[model samples]
Target: MSGLADQGMLDLGPESLEYRMIGPRPDQAPTLVMLHEGLGCVGMWGDFPDRLAAATGCGVFVYSRKGYGKSSKATLPRPLHYMHDEARESLPRLLDAIGFQRGILVGHSDGASIAAIYAGSHQDHRVRGLVLIAPHFICEDVTAESIAQAHDAYDNGDLRARLQKYHADVDNAFRGWADVWLGNDFRQWDISEELAYIRVPILIVQGEDDQYGTVRQIEIAQEECYCPVDVALLPGVKHNPAREAPEVTLRHVSDFVTRILQGHEAAASAA
Candidate 1:
């Protein structure tokens, strides 16, 4: 495992990843390995990571996966199970390489789905809990419709220009995510079974009026997960909770992490 102070590009075999680390390292404190949305990169997270680190006193490791941000370009026409591929393959390497000890997998949107897959697919006791913001467990009709609209926006609106600021190759970042989800085959995409296998607790924060998905996503997690499930359905909020309701998101995430990991720290010290 590499040192937490390690900066610049992360070596992940054929493709290196761009990353930013904040606050204490893993050895000093529990870490929060943040996974961005399908179209998001390390830059898009902005100052949220900084606030989270200050609030929780934990390190925050944010990175852009392949095909997004400044990272290497992904091959075109990505496989239907691209999220699965990332969960089982790339994510594990990232955690081990960074010397991740104990912490939660904090994810937003697609990042949340990937986190669910990784936790359920393995028995990693180090992953103490999960903080999922706008996670999708199954593909909904609304999801497809919203993605179709996004295609139009990307082509015609200022969305492309806005995205270009954060992504090195905007089309690759957008198309890699948009194409797979828009495919007819993706309609049947579901990862609910993975939830049942997750042994750690979970905290799901979703927008009540999310255009991309409905509360059914939350229902799936509630129905399938055996671990303790906490839900925060924010009223008048949209897909991106952190952006739309930063303070609320910060409070929920920081409190949950403190309750889980900080409490654990106290108990361990007592023992």
Candidate 2:
């Protein structure tokens, strides 16, 4: 049942935020929730989720936000509170709607920020662990510069077409992210405060060659998290660590999730 799609709706104010689910074993084992990047969707994730799920024997849950993939397109402009709202309001609603009480979150870029915010804010929830691939904790000059380059590549280069292979509506997904980040208001966006509240173990991964973020971003996350934070820098890897170094990423993810769960079980037994 690879790539099988399902629909889920979460109530966010007066509007119903729709999401699309992909991959098999959505409810099986140590369920791994795959959150896409700012310009990503279920299709954009390619076969990574399926392969990871198979390798780890974990149920994989993937969902496209209101504006991306087969889910409902966003009509309103993205506000400064968008990411915060997603982490605080939309995520919990979606999880509760789907009955996901506990699971590991695999997040990238914007999705990674959302994961950090959620893990920090929801003190009572059961987030077994987190795997942050190319996550960011704060706004930096380097991030803005890379995003500017990405804008040029998207408009002047063939990057948009290359991305079309992964997105059904590539332009919508691409511009939605680009415009939001490059906007005047978005320059103030930062999530470091949210990271301080997270008490769960986290695996922060980044590629040394990643143009969008620097080592400082991962280091900030390590400092903020209340629990153990394992940092891995993949050599010769870029912003898309999972795509560029699947084997290495998979091994780390599998080992981290298993060890965390085992440690929890041991503590429970002792108690």
Candidate 3:
């Protein structure tokens, strides 16, 4: 954990994203690229990345997206295509800059959706698998309701104060995500089509009691994706699986990562 926290920041020209590297060297094994949630940042992830690294013996790289954490402030009123732009533009650049050759994307919430978009859109062979935590394939009524509740909590409750600990501009982080989701135009926002093109194996982790999304999200992935898909529905958990059910989530993710790495190694050796 100490070593993981000691990692430095990455300057991606226009926006300097803060990042931490954990576990083994990038050259020694496959990497786990973690993408935080909408209102999440590098610091917000806490020791989950460290625990994951320890469990899998894989290098883990966690980064805060633009306008979050120590990254540069984002332009006001983010477009409807902000997530798409991240998948199509910023993510690729970040991967290249880090020299990511072989890896799995471990993403949560908004970050999970971005990972799905990237896997479907890009035929990058380096990406061997995906670990989607609390992913949303399409906009749902519950999503809007929960976000609206969050908006109120941010305004009148302690949610903003808690989030401020992680985000440099807490308002930007929360509003950018909440505004887009709560907007009428966002009702049509769906990435199910993206699932059809993803060639790698996938592992979906969802809390049965999640307020932000439902089992429909996982069902859509099962129905659309051609690749093998695994699921873990935790009973007493909510939106944040990594936080609420760390041990179980860690075991599932670590097993999936190990299997993929082992398979890749076997294939390479045979060739």
Instruction: Please report the candidate that would top TM-score against the real structure.
Output: 1
* Predicted structure 1, TM vs. truth: 0.97
Model 3 lDDT tens row, 162-187: 99988888898888888989999999
Task: Flag regions of model 3 displaced more than 4 Å.
Answer: 1-6
Give the TM-score ranking, best first.
Answer: 1, 3, 2
Q: Tell me the TM-score of model 2.
A: 0.88
lDDT of each: 0.93, 0.77, 0.91
lDDT of 3 at 5: 43
List ranges where model 1 is wrong by over 4 Å. Answer: none
Worst 10 residues of 1 by lDDT: 1-10
Error of 2 at 127 (Å): 0.8
Which structure is stronger by TM-score: 2 or 3?
3
Best by lDDT: 1
Candidate 1: tens digits of C-alpha lDDT, residues 1-271: 4365545688889688999999888888899999999899999998999999999998999999999989999998999999999999999999999999999999999999999999999999899999999999999999999999999999999999999999989999999999999989999899998999999989999999999999999999999999999999999999999989999999999999999997788988999
Q: Which is the winner by lDDT between candidate 1 and candidate 3?
A: 1
Q: How accurate is candidate 1 locally (lDDT)?
A: 0.93
RMSD of each: 1.1, 3.2, 2.2
Pairs in clash, predicted candidate 1: none
